[model samples]
Target: MRGKRDIERELIHAEAKIESLQTLLESAQTDRQELKSQVTKLQDALVAARAPEAYRDQQIAKEEENRTPRDQAQIDKNRLIQKTTEGYMHALERPMDVDDLDALLARSSMHDIKGPPSLHGNDES
Candidate 1:
């Protein structure tokens, strides 16, 4: 009789453990669903923030379709003007004139004046 009572007690303990585990599994499943819903809401918000609206997209398409050769010619003209401006800027940056060249060379190696610079071919002596 004592053995039978011990077996009955163990059986009750095992059933209680199974019930606790089932309750824990249900809670975990509920938490997983809530997390999935939160993730979906966050993804939708991110998409709306990053994507352009349909009206802006249509305006860009219409503008592209309406562009003419005149617009292309204007773009070419602006490019030419920019190239010419860069050339002018480069030219201005260098010593082009003879006096400018003389001044540049003189400044580069300039020292305390000892005597006049030697003139090789232009000497009258």
Candidate 2:
């Protein structure tokens, strides 16, 4: 049999691991909830978009009726923000006066393109 000190140390390490696992489990649960919410939103949008033209208006109205006034306001605000973002992207196609590429690098989350890391800090600047 192992010495008492060794047994106690092993028990302590096992307790620490149990605690770490519990923390990770809780974090995973929270992430799952977030993902479920996102999936539900996407599913609702997909249904609304794909419904037949005759039913589309009714489906949209039903969805809107289900939302609280504050939720509706937020939805409207999001749509406006999306439209403004698209306008900004279109504006970027016009001649940019900034001579330095570093100046362009200062913007985070390009409203125009994809695949670049969203780092805005002075990496090459």
**Each model's TM-score?**
0.40, 0.41
lDDT of 1: 0.64
Model 2: per-residue Cα lDDT over 15-91, one tens digit each: 99999999999999999999999998887677667775535656656776787666667887756665566555765
Clashing pairs in 2: none
Scored against the true structure, residue 67 in model 2 reaches a CA lDDT of 74
lDDT of all predictions = 0.64, 0.66
Candidate 2 Cα misplacement greater than 4 A, ranges: 52-125
Q: How many pairs of residues in model 1 come into backbone collision?
A: 0
Return the clash pairs for model 1, or none: none
After the best TM-score superposition of candidate 1, give how far the Cα of residue 120 lies from its true spot, in angstroms: 82
Count residue pairs with overlapping backbones in model 2: 0
Candidate 1 off by > 4 Å: 52-125
Worst 10 residues of 1 by lDDT: 108-117
